[model samples]
Target: MQFDRKDKNDATLLDLYTQLLYPRMVEEKMLILLRQGRIGKWFSGIGQEAIAVGSALAMKETEYILPMHRNLGVFTARDIPLKKLMAQWQGKISGFTKGRDRSFHFGTQEYKIIGMISHLGPQMAIADGIALADLIADKKQATLVFTGEGATSEGDFHEAINVASVWNLPVIFLIENNGYGLSTPINEQFKCKDLVDRAAGYGIEGVQIDGNNILEVYDTLSDLAEKMRKDPKPVLVECLTFRMRGHEEASGTKYVPQELFDLWAQKDPVKCFEEYLLEQRILTPESIAEIKADFKAGIEQEVEAAFLEEEPVADTATEMQDMYAPHPYQPVEPNQQSAEIRYIDAITDALKIGMQKHNNLVLMGQDIAEYGGAFKITDGFVDLFGKARVRNTPICESAIVGAGLGLSINGYKAVVEMQFADFVTCGFNQIVNNLAKTHYRWGEKADVVVRMPTGAGTGAGPFHSQSNEAWFTKTPGLKIVYPAFPFDAKGLLLSAIEDPNPVLFFEHKYLYRSLSGQVPIGEYTLEIGKANLIKEGEQLSIITYGLGVHWALSYLDEHPEINATLLDLRSLQPWDKEAVAAAVKKTGRVLILHEDTLSSGFGAELSAWIAEHCFEQLDAPVMRCASSDTAIPMSKVLEESFLAKSRLKESIDKLMAY
Candidate 1:
């Protein structure tokens, strides 16, 4: 154990032998497996092992490590079981995701590691949020998130680091500047001398080190990790390493120059360290060979056993449960003398209630603190909950949601305001890909509520007024709650904040004041998937949500003879299938309507469902009324014509006549 190391650990640099060997062995084995048609794809950290192993060893086991796709050394350093790792590579049901996913896209709570998705930049923000969660809870722990120099080009990288800097979060933004981002060279990426130099823009400490020197990385990070406990803040560390292999095993490196490759090959971190250890007389040749043999033997045994494990069978009955894991609805009878408030006010009330009940509840968005948000939904949240809880962020949707995801996984319920639902496009990657798939990928909980102000009625135009529920309806793991009234807005928000999954709460901008109801004054969580059967009838059934539900009511009031059942489908995903089936079966004819454009709207899916399941009871073809298949025009006349009452009336008349 004798070695030249000044790390916080009592252990010497020799302890990293196993950590260094593991990822290299895994890379070799994965390449073999890929050739044998056993594994799909592999991104090898062939030259960057020192960065991963050293940084991971530098931090405590309690601290979190959010790894990138190529950070296999992090998993190795974390001491993840060889058998489980092999099983994951083999895509066995015994793996982290139950063989539902493959590759480096799985993580578990036990390891304090977050799995990597394809987009690496967003994880930086998630790391920020996890660090923020601990900071708010008075916990002393930091987060280490890794990425390649290529990821620095992403907007999320800037957004994430900026937020980390602003909050002084205990996060280590590590960049493996591996010369090339997949295939594009570093010169094509940025003008900065070193990637760490970008840290100056965020007003954080920037340091570049010889990543091949494992002792240097270990000592630096170990000391930094200790300092973070006392004074938490972000540190940008650039590990000047090389990706010896291509982006993936199959992506050959013809674009790399032979001379540069030869130079780096001579400076291989593992080979260099092994030579140094031998020179220092730490571990003899026989001991090093023995250690290598043990790693190889264990890897061979695990790979063989994992290869023989039974494949995951598709039991859709259980597999489908990953789409929406709703919190079980506890029957909450609202107390008497409950105050009634406007829909917008009720939103604030729900946030207050959520914060009061759960100290872990947090809110983040642009203009959400001092200005109280673009719509003032979080008017007093900052004052009441304090700046740490209710944070005002720059206009970075992806970072907000990404950090929200981080907060949720770290025992905090995070509410992210999208400012405008239309702008959700900015954070679409975080919300749809990561947030929607976290649970399904690794069985990880993502308790995030993305509050989106949706719909067009006040001439807010396409950018501000979009019924984007259809966008998320297509995503599997997200629960879409479009509250049509004040009571549902408050109750469903409470439920959303309480739910153990990511929920997209769409509050209709037009209905913010146009619709109101007697909301319960006390804490109450309404059932998420259940629809409010606004009006019951026998002739025609109208399935709608959000502002469409109100429009249906207006039409029903004007034409009593239509004999319609207005179903306010509050939750779009994990929708009340039983209620919808019964309602459609009872009414024979169904009309699906929404404020979103007709083409590919949720109404299309509803129409198809009715045609598929309730065709036997149907006397007429299902009718659908929606805004025309065009952008919501800025002109009031054009917008009105696009979503006119006449469209609904015509559709109803045809259904009745049929």
Candidate 2:
């Protein structure tokens, strides 16, 4: 062997041993805290330290790593001080997230480490996108993203790998197959003979290695990282290991068989490496005793000191700012009244204005680069900004959103497009669970705008056309915007881009090219949670948004005698409740209209709120005009007849009579 393992002073072997020892000590200390009730819980990396250390050591100090909860050993290897980790786990104010987050849910970008979400698979796509960002900047670096055997079953895992392969992203998928998925054995979960074999399906390299062998893992990954840096290719390496302890501090090994646990105990990675060091005569008994004593003393002192840190105080004054983005409706530049521009053109101009204003802006979507997006709303954008800024991604909505999240967190504001509004279903987890909760969880800025080309009136079938704005309104931390006019679309989109939190910008497909108004070409922004009363009247108020606003306007113009108030609710979430309340209070009759299915549409929420607050003032019942809860038809006739204009007019007449 080139490097003699028999030698007492082998630098690589000694370094590897030291790197793997930190997590073991931390794990042991965490259990002590748990027993004393100082710490609530901890996910032990008892048997997987070699996997964590080896994978993290594959990269340089400048490179980034997105670690799973079990990959605690990397923090010590990468030089994030043990004191900070203790403080974070103890939920102290000195923690990375200021005690707002718990367990492995906190990270520091200065150390080039990203913490894991409870849903671990989503970070794979996020890491891939981070790699793309570095690749675009010519960083010549590879990102290490970790996951377990169970996460491979997630659609996010498959989608991320496929997209990375398609783009040839420089990322390493380090899979620690611990022979169980939280007590469900691998045999019951996966049918494949070897999980590594699935790598060929994506046209990438795959290998299985001895996860318990510290020297073997470190040497293998060191070479692989060099090769990947030279040539960007995604690789999946599955490590065969076994969990020595239960899934977490709360979970026990009751489900694990006695024989299996005993079998893995013999091959415990830490003990095996320790025995190797002893056999090689790397240190005398006195030296080994000194190292052990040092680790034990430091663990106790650091943990005790961490307890002295104060708990984070609740800052209710910033609660409103933390939950949503800054509503920067105060415009800096003035605008002149220009002739009508297409809705699609207005969206493109808004993006241009945003990118010109802010240097750290990126765009991601499928067929967005050369094809100018599916709708060509981004036509000629790549030429203006280059391929690096305007990215053409794979047909993985989850990856696009996840990557946007990674970019947004790392100082760059991102705008991700869902080619079709219905396809947002593919990325719902990233949107609803991950993106929506960032600000609420740790006060992290989810500064990304998801442009959803929504609504149906073009005879497109159900799969391509959908009004999903109502679905996300249920989430607290998200801001939803659906613009009715080209003017609102331009202004609100710029505001969405500049906001500090995630914004869902829904642009109606029916209005993309067909709808136009006297929109200004310069930069201006409308308030996020405000509504415009297009027409005021004494009889009743027709509260509508998007296409409903236009339809109601046409009907109201034809019947001036009706004398109704029409409101354009551009901002869907955090809606203009004060304006709505006053209008409903004055008229005493309310008709909520939308193009979504009548039941549980966003209008239902509006009606429910009105009933709760303004019921006594209302003269009659709150009525809704919308389509039936049926799949959209392909035929134009059926679609039009099904989405009837007469319904809105008739609903209005009946409400007036009542």
Candidate 3:
């Protein structure tokens, strides 16, 4: 019951007790505010305060901690200003997320804390990325990530732990076995005897402790953290505890047995720790009373001041500022004199140039390090960049993508490749929720380029041959790039890497080997959100991107007298609106084309925009040519019919005649 470390004197014990008491008092006050409707809601960590406070105190000052919604003590233990904390919870302008999000959904780099996303599982993989940075830099710092026993069933938890173990990253997977997840008990969540037992499957050490015992939790994690710093390896520590309140205030605790609360009240973390301090003579009754009274007063004053501060206004003027890190677009000068190369080689050349130019640039994917990826785009990159920068990850899309976000958080540029573009579904949550939302939510840069080799070809069938660009185009925080030529592929990839946003670079697998064009070697970047006018004319405008551009060019070559404008839109999200408007104004008719399915495709958005804005200038209704609404087939003949490239020529003729 007593921590008798000679080095950690009576003063250290008293300080730990103070740290534990602060969040308890803060939660008590916040609960009152919640009842009064002064704040929206709170995820109270009243009885389980010891796990957060003890583990946070055990960590070195510079180390990072990823805390779940219930771990408010982690923030208070690190001494994040109570004023700002209250503002964040109250949705005030002075909060860390600037009132964009609320209730521990934000993180601050100044305190080395990465806040948890609502998914409850992706943060584990993100912690691997933070620890991977330390491993690469040879830093003696370990990261601690908190999770609930219920979340262990999430695939990200398994993927993250497997990756950390394989890479020997210094991470502490802290699982708080809080007895229930929402209303479901432990038995319904998993079949294992204890959650820590699952760690053995990951080939890592596992430990379980009484989560309510502040002295035990602190000592166990402190020793483990020290060992990890010296010899980096992951460890799973399961802390047995109970959630004393409802999942949220509105959820209520009626489902929890009153007898269970009665039993847990006798072993409340705060009361037991306070009792321990008094019994050990670390502090007298008067000092404990003063500490509690002072903490209560501090919480009250800070909350009142936070309420007095200005609330966030919905201003459209500054709304777009932080959506992406500032990187001005630079126009590309087409270098015809450069040597000819295949599209895949151009991508290879760009990645080579990127690694050489940016010292902190890293590549992560399955089999990328030694096997050079499935497409062999990074054939010899492992030799040039070494294993530290070129990482081969497990077949866990969610974890690797989240790790890339983590690296970006730690001030590095990462390029994460999906072995096949279709495989991106496995990691979709990290992309749409974590990576895409990071900057807009908490002002965290997601400087990552997700290389997606997309499109239907090579008889690869539905799974591997998907033109999935439309999937991410609808997500706001992402930038989509789909180039049609070798020169553009090399230039735009370099540009995507330089842009401080989450860019989905979709490379057409069909064009990799089949298409060859003059590419300027070495470092060059093309402007994103700009369309390249391949050939300009006045009769009709053929608006397309990716493989559709190639199809349009071939048709135009055969019919030289059509007098049509061909626009290859490289960026899908910020498609060249000015260029599109100009093309629509110059040519009275428009034909939208793409390789993706016709329904809800990117072309639908373009066609609707053209119909809405250029209705007055139009000579006829906007036409569209795309694949039919069916999965890409394996047979080459079926795929060609599905793609309907022949329809592009017919659509052009109809638009021209109109």
Candidate 4:
């Protein structure tokens, strides 16, 4: 139980004990708060406090820590204000998210701690991104990510670890195996007895230790952290602990037998560690009682302070803060000559322009280099940009996006191709948690662009025939752009590549070859967030984007009497709220349309915004035109009926009647 290292002195042990006890008291207080209805439900890290505190102590404050939901212990140990922590539990504006986020979804970049992404298994990938950023900065700081045994089942965990091993990233994957993943026990979750064994598959070193032993956890983590600092490779440490409480405060022990609970109770990690401390003559019973009493009083005082704190007023201007860096939008010159161009050619030209302007630019995806990408958008890019700049990766979506994040932090303008937009779901964690929140969390920009071929009506069917722009639109910090014409495609793409934030550039597969438009011959970039008025009218505003804009334009050509204003929102985030509001006010009628599902679709956001801001200007109720909630079918007849055009025409007719 004792350490031989010189650093492991009495002072270190006292610090470790203090670290362990504080989080324990916080977790206990949170459970009581939940019962009293003062705070929301919580995920407790009761018995596993030793592992959380110990591993956190081993890491320097300069190093980044990406914690999972159960790492409240580590957050407390890292000096995250106890009052703020309690405020987060109470769902108050004083919390990290200002009451926008749920309990356990807290974070502070000031502490060098990346926020805990609520997703079950993306923390490992995010850790890789932080480490990559550190490496790019030429700093020695490392990244440590905490997860549970259950998360190992996710493909992102393996994909992230594998890439980290291949690149020798300075990251430590700390798996807190508390025997159960919610309800499924570790024994039933995986065939292997030890989760660390899986690390061998990725050609990485793996270790297992007694998570209950604070000293043991500290020694192992400190040793690995030192190794990571020097060699800079990914390591997995499976800390075998036990869940002393239910998964969450709301989860009862109905499935867990009473006998098994009694058996595990005797070996409770907190109690066992306390006994060890007593047996080693490290402390007396009276001293332990005094420590507990002090912790309780401290927590009570922090809770009182948090409850007395005033809530932050919701600011409308703050919404525009992290959307993109503060750069004045420059309009393309009116004299710029236009020429007919192909969609793929436009993409290639945009990449070339982006790379020439930004020396830190990097393009990556499966078959993107020599193979020229699945759609030939990157054809000859490797030869033109060199292998270092344009690289082809293996068919691992999670790894591809995860590594892209890493490279971006190193000062690279990364343009990652998802092959097809449908495949983006595979790397959803990297897109949503890491890329989307990078700017919002740290105020540091990640100039990364994700290019994916989207939309149905191309016979791609179910998996391949999805329009996923709605997904990214729902997520904050990401600028979603879907260009219908080749000109906007090139111009908007160049803007996305140049911008100092994440952009989800969606391309319609059908429009790549089927549609042709005039694009400027020379270098010119278009501003994102500006809506293009294809046709100005006063009868009704036909608000739409992407391919839907083409449909609205065509419909406008036939129905000139309707005098509908066709608004093409080139960017979904930081969308032209001003233009939309003005158009809605002038028209006195509005029709929101998109090619996404009707329920919880991107149109809902547009409708909600208009209803809140331009409600008084409306002459009629706001109308929505979107695809049905059913999945995209293979039949052309079914697709035509379910797509945006049919819905657009019908909704427009109804709006005119009103």
The lDDT of each candidate is 0.85, 0.84, 0.90, 0.79
User: Model 1: what TM-score?
Assistant: 0.96
Cα-based TM-score, every candidate: 0.96, 0.93, 0.98, 0.79
Order of candidates by TM-score, top first? 3, 1, 2, 4
Q: Which 10 consecutive positions of candidate 1 have the poorest summed lDDT?
A: 1-10
lDDT of 4 at 514: 83
Candidate 3 lDDT, 1-658, residue by residue in tens: 4444447788887888888888988999988888898888889888899999999999988999999989999999998999999888888889998889878999899999999988999999999999998888888889999999988999999999999999999999999998999999888989889989988899999999999888889999999999999999999999999999999989999888999999889889888877877787887889988888888888889989999988888977566766666677775565546888999999999999899989889899999988888999998998898999999998999999999998888778899999999999999999999888898888889999999999986899999999989999988789999999998899999999998899999999999999998888667788889899988898888999998998888888888888888899999977898899888888888889999999999989998998888889988898899998999899988988888595777777777676
lDDT of candidate 2 over 1-658, digit per residue (tens): 1223533357777777778887888898788878888778888889888888987887888888888878887888888777888888877888886776787786567888877788879989888878877777677888888889999999889988998898788888889999888989998878998888889999999988888887667767777778888998999989988887888868888998899878888888878887777777875567667877888998888888888989888788665556664454566453776768988888999999998888779999998888999999888888888888998887889988998887776668899999988999999989997788777666567888999998888889888767889889998789999999988899889888888788999999999888877878688887788999999898999999998898899998888788888899999887999999988987999999998887788999999999999999899999998887788787888787666354888898899889
Best by TM-score: 3
Which ranges in model 2 have alpha carbons more than 4 Å from their true place? 1-13, 36-38, 98-100, 312-320, 325-330, 356-359, 615-617
Span of ten consecutive residues with least summed lDDT in model 4: 1-10
All-Cα superposition RMSD per candidate: 2.2, 2.7, 1.5, 5.0
**Against the correct fold, how does model 3 do in TM-score?**
0.98
lDDT of the structure predicted as candidate 1: 0.85
